[model samples]
Each structure stands twice: as C-alpha cells, then as structure tokens.
Target: MHTFGSRRDIDGLRALAVIPVVLFHFGFSTFSGGFVGVDVFFVISGFLITGILFREINAQRFSFVDFWARRARRIIPALSVVLVAALALGWLLLTAKDFSELGRAVRYQALFISNILFMRQDGYFEPASDLKPLLHTWSLAVEEQYYIFFPLLMMLLMRHVRHWRWLLFAMLLVSFGLNIAYLERKPDLVFFSLPTRAWELLCGAMLAVLPASKQAVKPWLYQVAGVVGLVAVLVAVFTFDENTVFPGWAALLPVLGASALIWSGAQGSTWVAQVLGTRALVWIGLLSYSLYLWHWPVYVYANAISIDGIQHWEAAGWMLLALGLAWSSWRFVELPFREKRVLAGRKPVLVGGLLAMFALAVTGAVVRSADGFPQRLTGKALEYAQARDWRAGQMKCMLVTSDKNLDKACLVGANQGEPATQLFWGDSHAAALLPAIENNAARQGRPVWLYSMSACPPILSDEPRQRCKDFNQRTMEQIRRLQIKDVVLASNWSLYVYGREDGDRKVLLNPRDNAAEAEARMAAALKARVAAIRATGAQVWLFKEVPLQRKGTISRLTSLARVGRSAEGLGRPLQEHLARQGFLSALFASMSAADPGVHVIDPTPLMCAGQVCSIEVNGHSLYRDEDHLSDIGSARLSPLFAPVLLGTSDN
Candidate 1:
C-alpha cells in the first residue's frame, strides 16, 4: 500500500512555499503572495498524513497508539526545544507585558488552540505586524488541530462504512464547501477555525485512496500535470498578500497543485522529486519543523527591540541560526528519541516524556493567565489597562474609524437632507474635533449635524479615491442642494495640499507645484470651499493640523516592556517612541506650512510641549494605539474648539 511512486514535484512545491514565505516576512517588496506558502504547507500536510493513515488502514496495521507515537517522534522533540528556548528568550527580551503575552502564547501553543484564541483577540490592522513572536505558530496550531481529529475520523470511516472512499469524498465536499462559504462572509473566523481548514487535509486523504498501480498512468501525462501543478503552487506563493482572502476559492491553487503533483507520480528518478527529496529540501523539511518553530519568535522579539522595522537580512540570519540548532537537535535529540533500534525502548518512553512536557506547557499558560496568578501584579499597570479605549467600545474607532459608518445615528442628526442651524464637515482629522463640536454645539444651543468619515478629508472631489471620492461627492451635493450653512472645512490637509507640491511623494491627488504652491492651492481650495458655502449663506471654520503622533504608542510601549524600561515616569510615550512615527512628523510639517485660514485652530499645544508629545493625562492615556488621540486626550482638548465655532476667534 505504501509503494506508490515518490513525487519530487511536491517537494519542489514545498521549496516554493518556504522561500516566498521567508522572503515576504523578510520585507521583500514583491511577492505578497508569499503568505500563501502556509496554504501550500496545509495541502502537503493533508496529503502526507492522509497517505500514512490510508496505507496503514488498507494494510490493516493502523493503530492509534502507533500513529500518535509516530507523530510524537516526528513533531515533539524539536518543538519542545524551541518552546523551552523561546520561553527563556521571551523573558530575557520581552518587557513585562510582552513577556506576559509570550507566556500566554506559549500556553496556547501547548494546548493546540492558539489559532482560534489569537483570532478572537487581535486583528490585522494592529500596528505590530511583524512583532508577534508566535504569529506564525497559528498555522502550526491549525495543522495540529487537523492531526488531532482527522485520523480518528478516518478510522471511524474505515470501520463503519462499506464504501469508505465515498464517505471520505462526502466529508471532503462538505468541508471544502464550508471553507469557501466561510472565507467570503467571515474571514477572521475562517483563518482560525479547524473545520474550515479540514478540506485541504481531506484532499490528501482522497489521493491516498486513489489507485497507485503504475498501469493506471502514462509517463508524459504525469510529468506534464506534475509540472503544471508545481508551477501553479509556486505562482500562488509568489503572488498572494495579506489582503488576499484565503482558505476559500483562492486556496485551491496551492491545494490542487499539491494534489496534482502527488498524483503525477514523480518517481525517485523524477528531477522535481529528486530535488524535493534531496539532501537539502527534505533536510529543511526535517528542519522545516524546527525552522518554523524558531524563526518567528526571534523575529518578533527583534522587531520589538528595534525602533526601525525588522529587516529581511536579520530574518535570514535568524533562519540560519534556527537551521543550525535544528540540525543539532536532529542529530542529538531527534535521533535518540525516535530511533528505537539504536536507543532501544527509550523512543517510546521519550514519547511519554514529550507528552508530559506538553501537559506542563498547558499548566504554565493556565497559571500565568489566571486573574490572581502569583507575583505578576502591579496596581499601576492595572490602572493603565482600565484607561485603554477597549472598554468604551472604541475598538472600532481606532482600527477602521474611516467614514464608512455613516449609518451610525451619531453621524447624522437633526440636520439631514436639508438646512439646519449647523453642519459639521470634516475628515477623520475633523472627526477628532467631534468632542469639540459636541461641546461647542451644546454651549451655543444650535442644532448640528456631524458628517465625518475616517481618512476622507472634507473636500470637493477633484478626483476619486476608494472612500473619499464617493463620500465627498455625496456630501458636496447634499450641502449645495440643501443650502446648508455653518460648514466647517477640515481634514488631514497634509495629505494633498492645495497647490502643486513637489516632494519625495508624488501626491495621489490632483498634481500640484512646489511645497509652497501646494499650500496655496490647499488654501485656495479651502477658500473656494468656504466661498461656495457662503454663496448659500454659510459660515466655515477650518481645524488646523491636529498634532500628529510619532509612533504607535501602545505597541512601542509593549516594546519598551520587552526591554527593561519602567513604564513609570516616561514623559510622553509618543515622544519616547517617535522614531516609529516619522511618517506623522513629515505630514505635520507639511500641514504647519499651509497655515490655511479656513480658521487654523492649533490643538498642538493641548497635546505637545516644545518638541515633545505626551501620551498620558491625569494618569490616563492620551493616545489609544499610536495615531489616535484617546478619549482623555480628545475630551481635554474638546473645549478648545469653542472659540473657533462661536465666532469668538474666527467664524
């Protein structure tokens, strides 16, 4: 049953997956598709594991104890070393909070449920993209979950059904259908869930049941199909990115490519298989287990320590170190633990030992994560957590606060489809000024409409953007047709200043001249905007450049924790972490140059001092993650908007 021709093309495909995944993580510009390597791995895992199960079941030699023991020999020894070493490294390099986070991830990694857990917690928009030590482990957890349930299901199918192949096929169809449907509607769920990923493994299971007799195939056809399949998987590895919805139809490229290569029957003589099964690829595949384990955490810790982004060459070095360590383990620990012929019954005993180690991991995660886990308490840290925007339902506000939520009642008020006492027009930059608007409107006792969208500046659509274009077009048409007054012109005007601006950035908006001309054009646009509204008997006030933040304060703060810095007595965490926020400094400098009189209200003084920006106010956080001003920060400065709106300063 195990004598089917070896497929070298599939190993070629594995090489394809690993290289791109490594490169993309290392910061290469192209090949966002490199992430699809994880999908390719999934397909390969399904095929191999299923082949083992089918061959054993067909020979009537399948045993749960034996199968699990084999998995222990294959996966556990190197994994234990990585986990134990990563835990120690985490404590050394990670700050208190970061260490605690690592502890929890280690715990989950032990339990094999980390993918679902991580998904239920953070999201893709988080600033710490490459900084997570256990980020790649999510894929490992997904594979382990399949390993846990799949073999049992196969065993049950073989025992219960006369037509077991039909049963496997039915299960495959169901799992695949669920995968496609879930990815489209609930992507985050699809990314983590066990059921959604089961089909990829089942595809391999299907291949195992197929006839392996050489009489069933032609050599040329096998070669051609194998090449196409391998190439398709490689193309996917080089082409996909984080934005690509995965495990749905998009995942079929890697999954089917793997299946075709297996079915293509590349014998030992086949160059693709020879290369795949070569000393290097299989050696990496052997270490792939270890390489996968060690690479991500070290990379994450490195990102946490460095203010500059994690570099690709740095990842390469770490990968080499991981490879070296994996080789040592393969020689010293793996062989002794698995080769019972040499080590006697020690291999089986080692299996129990590794299982016990996993149990210990579960225990540690549980202990550390508990509410009263001993020795981890700091009252001040608790206070800081409480003040974070999390409890106030502001998670949506930070992650994707863009103007997409116009349907929210807060966006539109007494003034819709017609004139009212006031109209609030602004971009997300203007949205920051909302607490100010709310207060100003209350003091004035005027009816008001809050029209704001995230990232979209309140400007006439000279051109279309994904969000700003439709929002601006609809708003301008509404205000004009409704003859609304009290229009406030504001935005992160730093993005596309009015005039022709020549800078390092070629502005995506209408082309402008030099930097000074850009400001003038922006001023002209503001003036024209005010004039257009005034033509309908309206008043306009422009909120000048809101103080831009330098770095993602929280992530950097976590980084600081990764170091040995006391979060205490740090003045303006943003200032402390500013290197990460140079993008904002550039924008703020551009906007400061404009000084546009669509009422240049400077809230900079409220958040900044001389050259520094603070992240704490009255013992509360002033910024949420990085760019967003916190409720405390926003509220503290809300009253500052009073003078501008009441005509006490500029209306």
Candidate 2:
C-alpha cells in the first residue's frame, strides 16, 4: 500500500552486523563482542518495519493480515529449508539423545519460541551452546515475536492515544529498566525474553516516528554523527567479550549507534554511508539473512566431527562453505518466496507458510516421541550414544539448592534402616561417585548416607549462598548425630577456585576474588572443615576432583563413533590435569599429613597413565560430560574407597 526507497547503507549495515557474528561464532578472538550484531539487526528491523507501518497506517491502508503475510513470506521460506536440512544432517550426524534435542529445538523454532527453549536450557555464552546448530535462531525468534505484537500495539495507540510517541518511549524506558534490574539476578531471562529486549527495537521505532526536521540539517552534523556511530559499533565489537554484562547499559552503545547512523543517512549520504553503500558490503548484506542461518549449523557440525577442535584454517574453510550455501539459499529459496514468484498470492503464501510450520512441528514431535530414531545407530555408535546419561538414580540422590532438608538425602548400600556408619558428602561430583561407593559399601555390609548437593561443597565458609552454608552445617550436625565413623568429602574443587572456561563467575567462591585469593580462601575453608569433621571422631577421606576435559571434547566420542572414526588419543594431557590440580593436590597432602584421621584419595594414578588422562577405558567413555564421571567410569574407582568401606584402615 505504501513504500519507502531502499537504503544501500542499511543493507551494508546488515553485512557489518552479520560478519562479526559469523567470525565470533567460528572462534575468532578479535570479534569477541560480535554478538552485538544481533542488536544492530534488531534496530534496523525496527526502523524499517515501523516506518512501513507508520506510512500504511497514516494512509488508512494498513491490514494486519497483509502485514503478517509479508513477514511470513520473508522469514518462513529460508527457515523451512534450513530446518529440514538441519534435521537431515542431524539424522546422519547426531546421537539419539542429541537428535532428540535437535528435534526439540526444531519444535520450539517452528513456534517462534526457541528463545524461551534455549533460555531454559543453556546460557548463550556457555560451551554447551556451541554444540547447538540452531542456537542463533533465538534472535530470529525474538524479532518474530516483536513483529507479531508491535503492529497491533501501534494500531491501538494510533487509534486511541494522542500522545503515542510518549507512550512508546515510556514502554521503552520500562523495558530497559527491567533489563538492568534483572541483569545480575536473572541474566538468561533478561537476555532472551521479549520484555527485556524490547527497548533495543523500540529505539529504532522511536527514530522512525520522530518528527521530520523542518530546517535543512548541516552536512557537518551528519558527518560527525555517522563517524561516531560507526566507531561506537566497532569499539563494542573489538573490545567487549563474553564477560561483559550485556543488553543492559552496555547495549546502549550499539542500539543508539545504529539509530544515529539511520538518522544521519535519512536525507543524504556521508562518507560513512558511502563506505556502507559499497557494492561488496551491499551484496553481503543482501545475503545476511541466509548467511546468519547457514553459518552456525556449519560451524556446529564441523566442530562435532573434528577429533580435536576446529583450527583457524579449518574454520576458514567451513566459513567458505557457509558463504556458498548462503548465496545459494538466497538465490533459490529466499528470492522466489520473497518476490512472490512461487506462492504468488497473500492467502497462498500465508497458508503455505502455516502448513510448512505445522509439518515441521509434527515431524519434530514424532522424532522426539520416537527418541530421535535410535534405530539409526548400531554397534559402538549406539553404545556411545547411550553413555551420555548419568547413572540411574543419580539425579534422585543429588540435592539442589532448594532441597534444604537433610532427611531428603539418599541412603545407599547395606543396613539402610540402621544408623549410617559412613557418609558421602559434597557436590555433584560426589554424587557421581555413588555407583562406586554403593557397590563397595554393599560388599562391606556398611550403609552409606549420601548428602551430596549440586554446586555445594562439603566445606563451610562465608559462602554467597546461605543454603550451601546451611546444608554444610546440617551435614556436620548429621555427622555428630549419626555417630558417623567415616566421611568422604568430594566436589569440583577447581570450579569454585578458578571458575569455568566460559568465564562463569557465579559459581566461584567469590566472584570478585583473584585466583590466588580464591585458592587461599578455599584452602582455609577446607582445612577448617576437615578439623570440624575430625572433632566428631570421624575419619575424613578427601576425594580429589576428577580431571576435567576440554569443553565439547566428550561429545566428540560419540560423534566420532557415528562417522566410523577412531577416538584414540582423544584425551587431555596428564601435565594439564596435574597443573590444574596442583594446588588442591598439595592442600590435600598437607591436610592428611597434619592429621592421620584425614586421608587423601587421589584418582589421578588410576585415571591417568604415562602422558594422558584418558576420557575412556577400553572403548567405554569415563565421562558423561566435560567434567562429570559416567556410571561405568565411576565403577572403575571402586578399589580406591575399599580401605574405608571394608574397615581395613588403621585409622
């Protein structure tokens, strides 16, 4: 019904937004903050879509059906192709469990709620997210959710509210405030939810609806604005990293920067605009949508199949493949649907899009219900696929933060009704040792009480979580009350002291503490805890943490099996494992020497040999994930605890 001329600079801006995202996802260090490209895309979408809505509404030619049909035509065609292709690829490459997850992701994406699905699954910056081929679709989902609602809001406001601009501004402010307030408390929710992300889009909407300038603006002002805008975006892309608190105050840099560029280029071109309007950039921008869609899956699948991680050269090759696919997808899939050459009418396009989505949803459901077609794999591949799950009843025994009651602890081994003589206590790592402990205790005719909690160490100190403190306190009281003769302390000690590879500070002993300070604090807390346990006349067996594998390494075991590739030499170096555990190993040694009642059980000697700390034993994986031990792996450690279990120790 109405039209505004296309801006080549805006198209080029899309290239600017997408290239960094591709680089970042493919592990380029220079573009660590390339994720801000999504923010740029959001602003551009907001400005263009709002401008069209404003024009059509003003001309009294706006129709909700027409608006939705246009959006479906633009988005659904390429997305459908990607989804189907991803499923086909998944069938060939994924394990049953992973294929099920991919099916679940497809189900959510078809409904335009993959953002919510991912929010509940993993943080955007987490290593696990790198394995997800459709992870980038969350941004698309956010934009689609906006498209579904914003036009109706605009119509309602135009019909009833005279001061519509002020209302929209107030909404933006409210959304931004929510984003900042919950950034620390609920980062995932703030990152994925439409409410918190609305302000970024609203910035562009506000720019579109701003009153036209009555006076001819001086060219100097536009030049200054354009340069500053481009600089702000580039600075964010180069300087920011995963550690940055994002989509809060930090988001203003990209959101306002895109808005300023749009405003500056509204009437005439500046040098910055000319650069953006270059033919190469314009072409990349035209292919941006398909490029974004294609790149992540390419990266994910490539990484999945590699024995080691993808090197820079391998990444470069994969990116070339992505680019070629993006170009083909644009030419064959996006253009025909978008130009209405395939589904030529509004009703046909809308109906066809709906049917496609429905088909995908049903297909995903069937895949999920069938458990990702486990029949697709046999032999070692099937075995590897099944090994990803934790031991049966492991989840039931592991207490999380909310489970504060000590009576809820799982009792294993013999004589369950009588007072327990031994206890297994620590975090999820300790929980993983349940198979070994239970089997040993059963043979010894000793009942062991398990007081393991997720992320909660057995040690007591000034923990940020009061629940952990209380759990530890209750555990101590239980030792005294039960007259427990033995206490095994185990946890992911390195995680509390050094944090995760993804820069997750929340699980650290103190997020603000330096590495040395964290190590010192943990040592002091653990020493004090051992003394407290010794006072109860119980022997403390300090179980050293299992060696951690590199992120995404374990998944490669099954992935390799699927492709008939050997997983030999697929383990971390022993030196790296020893180095990570150096501090803890020395601390455990000192604690044991100080008091014979406190004994150290180091798993390294059994789990490692020669030069490598192996992730598998005789074709069976030792780890269920990067760091946690699998059930079969845990059983291999049964001998280490035999002295305590069988009452053979002199202590």
Candidate 3:
C-alpha cells in the first residue's frame, strides 16, 4: 500500500529530525532550536505519505483500509510497548496526583486527542511539560489526525479537480494564513492543532506532486540547494528558542529547508545525498521513530526521580539509554509488526492493534477514575500526597485572566454585622494566606476582605500582564471604597523579579533593561503600591513570602519516605531564599522604618529554622506542591496575623 523505494537520504533526513529533538529534550543548550526537528519530521512525513498515496491513486490501486492497516502496524506496536512501560514505571515513581494526571494523558493519547488535550492545557514548552511522560505523543496525535482526513481529501481533489496543484496550493495558503493570524493570540492552538500545522506537511506534498523536469540541471545548483537547506535546518535548530513565535512564518526556515533537500535528492546526486546515504545515518534514521517514542518518557521519569534534577552528563547517559531502547523496540516490537512475523495476517494484526489500544484506554480510564490508585502510597507517603490539596477556594478568591465581573464575593472572615476592616491583596501567594487570615480574623472578631489574582503581582506599575494593572487599580479603589483600615500585601515576589517556570517573564518597570534594573523598577513599584495603601488611610502590612521548597516538596518527601528514604537537601537553602528576597526585604524594611503606617511581617523565620526550610515538620507537611503553603501550613501562620489584626504592633 505504501512504498517510497530505498531512499537512504530520506533515512538520513529522519536522523536529522530525531537527533536534535532528542538533544533538545535532554536539555542541551546548543540545540535550543532543536524543536524545529518536529517541523522537519512533518515535511518528511508529508512527502513520503503523499508520494505513496499519489502513486497508488494514479495506478487505480489505492485502498484506504490497506493504507490504514499499514499505518497502524507501523505506529501501534512500539507505541503500545512504550505506553505500558510508562504506566508500570508511573505506578512506582509518580505521586498520586502526578500519576492521576499521567492517567489523563494516557487516556488522551489512546483516544488520539492528546494534541487537543495539551492545547487546552499548558503550552508544550512549559516547565510542567517535563513532568508529563506522554507530552511528546501530542505530535503523534497531530500526525494521525492529518492522515485520517488527508487521504480522503486528496482522493476527492484528484477525482473532481483537473489541476490538483492549485487546490493544494490554495489549502496551503489558508492553513499558513490561519497560522500567522493565530500566532499571537492563540499560539497554543497554532502549535498543537492540525489546521495550523498542515501547511508544513502540504509544503512537502506540493513538492511530491510537482511534475519532475526532464531537463538536466547543474550539479552545483543541487549542491547549493542542499547546502542552503541543511544550513537552514541547522540554523533553526541552533537559533530558535522557547520564546520564538513558532509554526508561523518562522517555520518556513526548516519547512522549506526540508523541501529543498528532498528536491535536491530527487534531482540527482547531491552532496547531501552522499552525506545522508551513509550507513550510520540510515541506521539512526531507521531507529528514529522508536527513538522519538522512547526518549521523552525516559527523560520525564528520569528527571522526576532525580533529587537535584538531571545534569547534562546524566542527560547524555539517558540519551544513550534511549538509543538502546530505540534499537530494541525497533528490532523487537516494530519490525515484528511491520514484517507480519508476530501478527501475521492483516485481520489478526488489525484486531491485535485494536485490542491493544482498547486495553491501554481502559487501563488509563481506571487509573484516572481511581485517582491514580492512591492505595499505592501508604503511611507517611499517603499523608504527604494528600497535603497537596489547597482548600483556599482558589477560583472563587483569585481573579482569573478573563474575570471582568468584579464582585466583592471573596470575603473570608467574621460576617455577623461586622464591617470588613482588613483587606488582603496580591497574587496567588496572598490567596494561600486565606486560611490563616480567616482563622486569625475569626479569633479577633473581625471581617477580612480577600482579593487575589494568580501570577499577577501586587505591584502598582504599568505591568502589561492580562488585566494586571487594571485589576490592581480596581483593587485599590475597592480598598478606599470599603474604607478598609488594615491592608495586607503579599506575593511570590521573587517570581516577578526572576521569571516563571515557563519562559514567560514579567517586566517590572522597564522592559528594555537587565535584571538588576528590573529589580530596581520592581522596588519602586512596591513603594508606589505602599503609598497608595497609606493614602487609603490603611496601615500597610507587608507579608513576606514563605521559604520556597525547590523540588515537588510534599510529593517528593512522601515518595522517598515510602521506600524508607528521605529527601534530604531537597528544600531550597535559607541563604538562597534570603538572597533572592534581599532587595524586596530591604525595601519592606525601609518603608516600614520611614512611616508609622507601614509594617512588615516576616514568615521566613517561622517557616525556616536554620540552614534549610522544611517541607514537613513533626509529621505534618508544611508546604504543598513546590512552594505554596498547605492549608495546615497556612494555619500555622495564624499567630503572626493575630497581633496585626488586633491593632497591635507586629514588632
């Protein structure tokens, strides 16, 4: 049903696509643009698949069933092996919450809707992506989805349209146009969806369907084309990064480059063909698909288990292991299915594939429904696993990005005819203190107003976050409108000063400056916010952020404890925390010293004892997911708020 003959150069192309992708995922800085490898793969797939369809359709021998069966045999066997291995390993290594999330991912992968699932969740480049073992499967989902519709669409065009090239070109233009249009506003959609990505494949299809010229071209021209194409791919692999607006016009570099190499190879002998036709390159290319399937999960689980995170050397070792796994999978799983050695008959192979897929889906559903099978954890691990639940009612209290209906409904304290005397303002960190504030206010017999927005710092700058500046302005007005006398300001201040896990960063004062300048700008913004609070006739109490736990605090601690091991030296050093917060701390102290109306309440001393901050204290977990305090942890801060709420000096 599908044959491209022996194109060793194409095999080399596969090597080109897989190596950089593996390198990039392994965290090699040199391969920053290595993610473009996916685009390269798309081009090669489009070319090869389109060529097969074209040949079969023209010969009047095309059968959708055979094509699909071939695809299933090629893809499913190794995929099933990897998925099963991941599930088994996940049962052992992942925390209950993470394992449950993995279950959801597995379900999506089985349904071949992982791309849509990922698009609806975080972007692929997000740091949390490292945790998802099935994250790489999104690309497979996209490719599968494309093949589902593409052959049918091509058949229709071939039957109806006199000139299919114009139709293909038109479709390409629409997809490319849509990609450009949605690049800024809907980047995730563009990145994950088939519509925006189809053009890259179409670029190869256009090449495949073009009439080959009989006239001989100069060898140097082919050489130049191959060189330029190779350079384009290399440049994109090195130059592009997580910050790049991808799959837009920027994708042209690798897409066109891949197209050029294919064209140059088809024309005759070129330097690229000579280079790509090497035995070693072709072998790696043969292993590329299996390699791609195995690499990400290997990296994900490896990183998950490492206490300090994977180093470059460790990553290299993992890469070697991935290569070994790829070879074994290719030799044992993929080849057996492809050659019909194991599932010999077509009906048997298809049935086996269907059953395998169904079993994986059922397993995934069970895992998800069972809440990642929490029974796997016991004693201390179970206690710590349950600690991740933050009972602060985040969606109700925190202002989401699209929130326009600003209702003062997030009131958290005493309510029996008592006016709201205390107000809390900041980001999600401020929201974490809700339990403590509610406890303290209930004891003091006072009502507290709680308002917060996630990832939006309480800085009064022209920060261009989604509704951040506007939200802060409205919050200030609300403070004055309510005539609140005591206002508490808190946030993950270091996050704003530094950046988030994803590459997205907050620009404090000046967008066109260094980190030191940004820190200065942030300090000034804090002072301005403080002045605004003072102007509202409110005593501003600056609540210092809690000590950050670096690894998955409670989860890591619990997982290790289950096996009679401890996550020692896992929490961030107290000195490192202090260093990150030094500027903010100084500003808070100076502001407090300058005005009687301003004060500072430090949570660090309470949370951290000497050298290290504790994830758990005396059998109770202090922190939740890496940095946020648990409900129990938040409750422990009740004493700090009591004096401030009672109109007594915290000092």
Candidate 4:
C-alpha cells in the first residue's frame, strides 16, 4: 500500500467541519449554517480519495478490489453498529407508523440510496426531519456513491484520455451547472442527488490532480490563502440559515473555502494551519466521522423523549453524550476495522460487509412487512399511531396542480346525479373537511361539489403558481355553470401568510413579499374572491384554519403514548393560535360585516377552550399531522357546517 504523510492541519479541518454540524443539529442558533460543514467534508473526501486513486493508477498498482476493501473497512463497521443501535432504540420508542418509516429508511440506507428516499420524503431543513434518526446518513450515501464510481472514472481517464485534469474540471462544472439550474424547480432533488452534489467532491479532486509546484512557495501566499478560506467557511457557518438555497451558488462559499484550505496546506504550514492543527481540534477531527454518525440519532431520540422541545441546557448535555458515544464508537468499532485488527483479510472484510448489509436489509424488510410490529402498542397509543392516516378518499378528492380535469373532482353527499347546491373549494385543508361536509350534506339532502387542490388557495391571485391560477379560474367557471348557491372557502390560511415554522417561505402568498405585505395581499385577494362569488348570487362560507400545533407536537401524540406517558399537555396554547390567526379573524369579520351574504365559521370554538387548543380529545388525536385535521377531527366540525347545508339559521 502507498501512503501520503498525514497532515495534522487536515485533521484539524475535519474538526472545523464537524463541530458546527453537531451544534447546528443540537439546536444551537449560533451554528445556523453548520450544515455547510457537509460540503466541506465532501471537498476533503474528493481531494483525499482522488489523491490516492491518482497516485495508484499512475503507478499501475491500483486494484479496485483492494480500494473497495479499504473503503469498506473504513465505513461499514461503525455504520453497522449505529444502524443496529438506532433500530433497537426505535423499537422501544417509535410509534408503529414511525417505526415502519424507520424500517423503510433502513432498507434504503443499506443500499446507499437513503438520499433518494429522503429527497422524496422531507427537506433536510424541515421540522419533521429532526425526528428521522437516519437523516444524516444522506451525506454518507452521497460519499459512498461517489466512492463506488469515481475511482473507476479516474482510472478510465488516466489510462485512456489525455488532458484528464481538464475533463475532470469540465465534469465538475457540469454538475455545478445542474445544481444551480434545478435549485429553484427541484430544490430537494438538487439537495439530495449525487448528480448535483458531485461538484463539491470534484472541487477537491481537481485540487488533487493539479500539478505540484516545483519551486518553493511563499509563506505569505499560503498564509493569505488559508486566512481567506477559513474566513469564508466561518462566514457561511454563521450567516447562512435554513432559508438559504443550498448546494447552489451559495454552496461555492464553503466548497471553495475548504478546497482553498486544503490547497494552502499542501505546501507548508501557515498561522491558520497552526491554529487548525491544535491538539484539541486534531483529536476532534480524528473522531469526526464517528461523531457525525452518532450525533444525529442521539439528538433525534433525545428530542423524541422530551415533553417540550429540548431546551438549550438539555441540548448541551445530549451533545456531550453524543461526543462520548462517538468516542466509544471510534475507539471500539472504527479503529479496529480501519487498522485491520479485525476482518484483517480483504476478502473477509468485503464479504463480511456485504453479509452485514444484507442481514440489516432483510431485518428492515421484516419490520416493514410486519407493519412495524403494531402489536407492540395497545389502546390510546395504537389509536394515536393510526391518526396520521388521511381520510380514505382524500388523495382522489384533493387535486394537485397538474390534475387539470375539473370533472375528476370527487362529488359528495346525496345522489351522484343530483345538482349540487353547495361547493367545497380551497386546498388540502378543505379536503380534510370532506367527511364532515358529506355527512352533514347527506343529513340535509344536499349534494356538494368538491373542487379542492393541494397548496392552491380558493382566492383569485396571480401570485401563486400559474397552475393554481388556472385551477381557480376553472373552478370559478364551474361554480357559474352549476349555479352553485353556496361556496365554502377553506385552507391552512396561516401557511400562506406566515409560512412554515422551519423558515420555508416559499409557500407564502408572495414568497418575495414581507409578512405585513403578504397579509395585506391575502386579505385583498380573499375579499375579492368572496365578493366575486357573492356577486354570482352564492353565499360564501369562510372557514378559518384549524389551530396549528407546535412543531413536532402531533407526532409526539403517539410517541408519548408509546411510553405510557400522558399526552394531556401536548398542544399549542390557545393564545398562540389566536395570535397567529388574528389577522385572518379580523379579515373574516370585516368581510362578513360588509356583506351579510358572507358568513364566517371559526373552528376555535370547537377545537380550543380554556386558553389551550388541544390536539386530542378523549384519547384520540384531532390532528393527522401538524395542522390538517384527521377524519375523526373533521367529523367533530360537523355542527359548524350543519346550518349552512340545511339552509337554516346558524343559531
């Protein structure tokens, strides 16, 4: 085997990459952009791996089997231990549905495709992502995938192609271009996929293959480069937040910074390098891989058991625990395999790694097939676990922007052929109310037309997607053609006005607009929409949004129940709900007062009382997720719509 002398500065750089990530995941506001650390790691990996591959291939000593075995030895053992530990903890703590999801995660992760699975599930910055024990593994999957194909590509280029460095550079540029191009349209895809993320690693690769200088380099130049690179990385770590469009142009900050640092250190040590090469930083850097692996699951499970969210002091304690676990994992698991003290033979390590992955995959499959062992819970816990299930026909009824066929809208209540006197129109929140509306309409002998779409409000506004604009127009035309007498406007109103708790502002009425501006726009748009429908001689029944529970609160319903803990206080404060909805409440009131034909329906009375907007009633959760009502929760709102459906006074 060939060896490159260890760079203590590089080890210190690893510490730089990991500390921010750990602090960020543990809810440290100071390390808001700590996620950029992953990008730094990518660059380091690309440089180091490419360095080894370039030298070996040039020497005609590169063996694919040997290279893969080394990689397996470095990665598999610690990873397997973490996976097993996560599954064990999940079984004890996770709800059946959550456990099932974890099982699915395990299956995909075993195949190094967890990034794909996560891309389809949740954005990395989403509040719910904190619950996923394996979420951090997406970065690992990206690295492993790069390892699988990159060495071969390097060999091909070295053996067959002249000017291989330029080819590698071109590939890097292409990947970066893809990342920037797709960031707006498919942010999640760009964030998780190897195609878009490859450039960061390739940046390091480019550094590796660059010709070494023959003459002595100036110390001043190295010092300047190192300082600038360190500053860039630190700036990104502090200034960037969840709202940043990542792995795009913004990603260049950390990626290039890390590359610069690596390049600077290649010649001779500078003051910046000396600072990085400190004993404490070097020790952390040595444990960086293990620390990264252990920290996320530790944070996830720690948050899972907490009644309220994890406090800062609690987070600090948990972080220390994660550090301890990481140290143990590095000491006992990572070092043994990496040093060839265990699974010493190449074939044994390779075969053993494959077998372990297969075994874990099979175990995941069994857990999934058995539905996460639902028999583990009983009574209220079981009920809460099942609460996430949407109403049976919701997917069919709630159209997406792409679904253009208005005729495909699900008809509900009375006979199918009956002329619908009432219409339910809005977004997914409206669809959640279908069960209540259908039951009430049936009792009142009134058929209702449903024209609901996901993320599309009932208001007429060009600010939303063009598809939404078209959907609203077609629905308006339908209301006119059918001579509908009543229209119910329902949506998660706060979502459009304030966006998600995780700083996702894209769903706002005008994502570019300020909060006050968005509120004003929403008010004007909603009023215009209501007046337009009223002008057509149809009464507008405006349903206010249900109380949105605190982030991760809904999932806690089942998790708390799983451990036989009372979920009595697991709800958002009524005052907090009122404060969030204050603008909408005032708007609805003004609209109703201005035009008696428009009636306001407030869910607060039904869903909240005594300064608390409870998520549960009689051991059953009212919410399916954070905001949307479950079927049972929706049925609870039957009385609110009963009078309108029956064409009687609400009193």
Q: What RMSD does model 2 have? A: 3.6
Candidate 2 backbone overlaps, count: 0
Please give the distance, in angstroms, between residue 549's alpha carbon in candidate 4 and its true position after superposition. 2.8
| Candidate 1 lDDT, 1-651, residue by residue in tens | 243445445555566667667666666767677777777778778777888888788789988777777776666666777777776665555444555666777778777777876787554324454445776778888888887788898888888888988888888889888888877567667777777777777787677676556664566776777778778877777676665767688888888887777666433234455556666675566555565666666666665554445567676676676567767877877787678543245456545756766775775575457522323424434444444443433333221344344443133222334335456666655555555565666666555566666656665545446555666666666677656555666566676653111122344355546656655555555555565666666555555555444333444444444354454333343444344324434543454455342344556677766555655654566665454555566667766666544644233
All candidates' TM-scores?
A: 0.65, 0.88, 0.84, 0.85
- What's the ranking of the predictions by lDDT, best on top? 2, 4, 3, 1
lDDT of 1: 0.61
Q: Higher TM-score: candidate 3 or 4? A: 4
What TM-score does model 1 achieve against the real structure? 0.65
As for candidate 4, its clashing pairs are none
lDDT (Cα) of model 3: 0.84
Tens-place lDDT digits, model 3, residues 556-648? 666566666656555677898888788888888899999988989998888887788766777778777777888889999999898667866
Tens-digit lDDT track of model 2 for 438-524: 989889887888888899988868988887888889888998998888899999999999999777777898999999999999999
Clashes per candidate (backbone, < 3 Å): 21, 0, 0, 0
Which candidate wins on TM-score? 2
lDDT per model vs. reference: 0.61, 0.89, 0.84, 0.89
Q: List the residue pairs that clash in candidate 3.
A: none
